[model samples]
Target: MPSETVVLLPGTASDEVFVRTVFAEPLSQVGAVLVAPRVRTLCERLTALDNASAGHPIVVGGVSLGAHVAALWAVRNPDRCAGLVLALPAWTGAADGAPAALAAKASARVVADRGLDAALAGTTGWLHDELTRAWHGYGDELVPHFEEAAESVAPTLDELRSLTVPAGIVGCTDDPVHPVDVARKWAEAIPGAVLTTTTLDAYPRALGDAVQAWQRAKG
Candidate 1:
């Protein structure tokens, strides 16, 4: 049997480095062609994946806005997707009041008004480093993606219930930005979907583990 191709996406304002660093190892165990595109809009990301997959069945996954986009795409192209791995899902349908969305909106505002340097300075603590590392790699173009991604919504509960591919949902238990409840809701809605609740302190290793297991089992 042929190996499945995997297109892992990064969160808002993040570049290929983030997703590649988090997923490259385990996904290699599956002998997958891992493509991480540097796109801002949902349509762009999906279109990039569509081109990268080269008509080969693939496992699609992403973090935050990326995760939301992956789920939405999987639903629209079930046969094209072999599996899904959603990490730190921001919100279900509308991104209204969601912590991640609000933060993205605020960052976009700062970037648009004060500029990227000021926006980077506004972040504090571990987030300061995390945001700086990803945002720096992206430069100014990432700002628009932050705003657009925050406004983008994933599939609804009804749509999730109709998903055919196996899904692996991971959420940070203590992260207000990406609620664990949202992950649980997705797991419940998608038949045979597995959910894992992790923490920010642990980084996204749990997400990688969950995806690896899902691929092994779902295969």
Candidate 2:
């Protein structure tokens, strides 16, 4: 596998640090350079993808809302996208009532009405830790960013069907917010896209699965 630049974005309210932890090692194993852009809003994430693709076709990917953004970008800019590594796709099109969207909205409200610590109270495990770090990182922009993500739309099935690049979609069967069915739908819609599943506790393996799927599709 030749060296390639892979631009990966973090989930809604998630920072580059988390994205790096998820993809950096797997990408390194394939000699791919991982560029985890620090993006706080939808516009920033899209802008990062656009800027990264200026020189060459690059693999674009992300988790949850980030995955939705990446897929939409690839659908519109197929020529600029070498491949896709979408994980935890939350919804097919409009975010109306989507679990992830609702979760974001609820969290936003909690953060707004109470406070960051109040919103995070009683949360434990890796997700809690990650959110603690990322939410604090957002500071004043956190609520607005959450609202933006809650209102955002992902690529429609028809739009996804138009994508020509090889794609690797990952899902967690136990994750209610980002259903595995959504991931399967994405794989089924995009031509030659591959689907893989992993538990939340073992999500790091999903990146490698996605990369391998992309390679298999390319073959």
Candidate 3:
């Protein structure tokens, strides 16, 4: 791996704290100069990456919505891509009917009609906590972002097939939203990409292990 620059983006309703759980300390120990930039919209993420990559190519990847955005970035900017690490991709193309998108749409409605606090209180489980943390931190723009993300289109299958950078992908067998099959297809599409699967609870570890394995194979 040597010394490399890696920036892993967070998923929708996710923050830097959450993203770091998957790729910070471990990668830093492995000599990766990490830069986890916080950008709100998909456009912002791409712009930030472009700005950050002015002088050097860097490894870029993310989870769920972030993964969707990162995939497109890699396909469009192959020359600036050192590697990729897509994890838990939600869908390909415009996933209007995707449960994750539907859920976001519905949540956006709740937040819009009621309010962030009201909607947050009504929601339950780990998702509830995650949304609370992410949305609240997002401030008033959260609802609109959620609404927009709900209908966001993914990079076409052709885009995925066109990526040639070294890639390491991870998926959770227990996560229905980020289907393991989609992850498998992504791995198969990207040239020489490696795939790793684990339970939802073990995804962070799986991602670390997968990246290490890919680096070993590359070496």
Candidate 4:
């Protein structure tokens, strides 16, 4: 059988380098060609995947905004996507007013008003903790990419409710941005979706485990 393709979509203010570094090795074990696209819009990203894969069935996954995008795409292209792997998906509506949104908005405003340097100084620590320092060692190279990514996508709640693909939502109990309850809600909404919770520090490990489990269930 042909190996399944796994598309990795990075969260808001993230780049391909960071997402690739986190999932490349572990996910590769499933013999999946990991495609980490740099696009921001959900439709454009999914279109890119469709054009690249040429109708091959795929597993779609992403972090934060990326996760939201993946979920939206999987629902829209249910026949093309085999499943979903969502990490730290941002909540919409009432869930948006949570601490995570306030912090993200504040950070975005600072970057838009002050500059990347100032915004990075204040927000880097938060992102580092959430992503387990995946982009920390890359220095300035990752910052501009992140800023560009953030500018590419905006939040849309309607898209969130339409997801239908079987999904695995990986969330952190301690993450203010991706509350465990919100993740659970995503799983509950999607038919046969599963919500798995882990600590912020164990993100990579939890993601790897969830991917493996999802793949096994598919077989």
**Alpha carbon lDDT of each predicted model:** 0.79, 0.89, 0.78, 0.64
Which residue pairs show collisions in model 1?
A: none
Q: In candidate 2, residue 145 scores what lDDT?
A: 95
| TM-score, cand. 3 | 0.90
Question: What's the ranking of the predictions by TM-score, best on top?
Answer: 2, 1, 3, 4
Better of 2 and 4 by lDDT: 2
Instruction: Return the top candidate by lDDT.
Output: 2
Q: Least accurate stretch of 10 residues (summed lDDT) in model 1?
A: 210-219
Residues 1-219 of candidate 3: C-alpha lDDT, one tens digit per residue: 458888778777677666776677667677787677877777787887788789888888887888888888888898998888777888888886887798788878888899888877875766677767878887877877888788887787789889877888887788877778888888788778888788956645565654664565355
Q: Candidate 4 residues 96-143, lDDT tens each?
A: 355555555666566557755676564445465643343443344444
Which digits, one per residue and each the tens of the lDDT, describe model 2 over residues 74-147? 98898999999888899989988999999999999999999999999968887789899999999999999999
Once model 1 is optimally superposed onto the true structure by TM-score, how far is the C-alpha of residue 90 displaced, in angstroms? 0.8
Which segments of model 3 are wrong by more than 4 Å? 122-128, 203-210, 213-219
Q: Each candidate: how many clashes?
A: 0, 0, 0, 0
Cα lDDT over the full model 4: 0.64
Best model per TM-score: 2
For 80-147, candidate 1 gives per-residue lDDT tens digits of 88888778877889887888889888988888888888988766775687778888776757777777
User: Runs in model 4 with CA error above 4 Å?
Assistant: 40-44, 92-98, 123-165, 203-205, 216-219
Clash number for model 1?
0
Candidate 3 overall Cα lDDT vs. reference?
Answer: 0.78
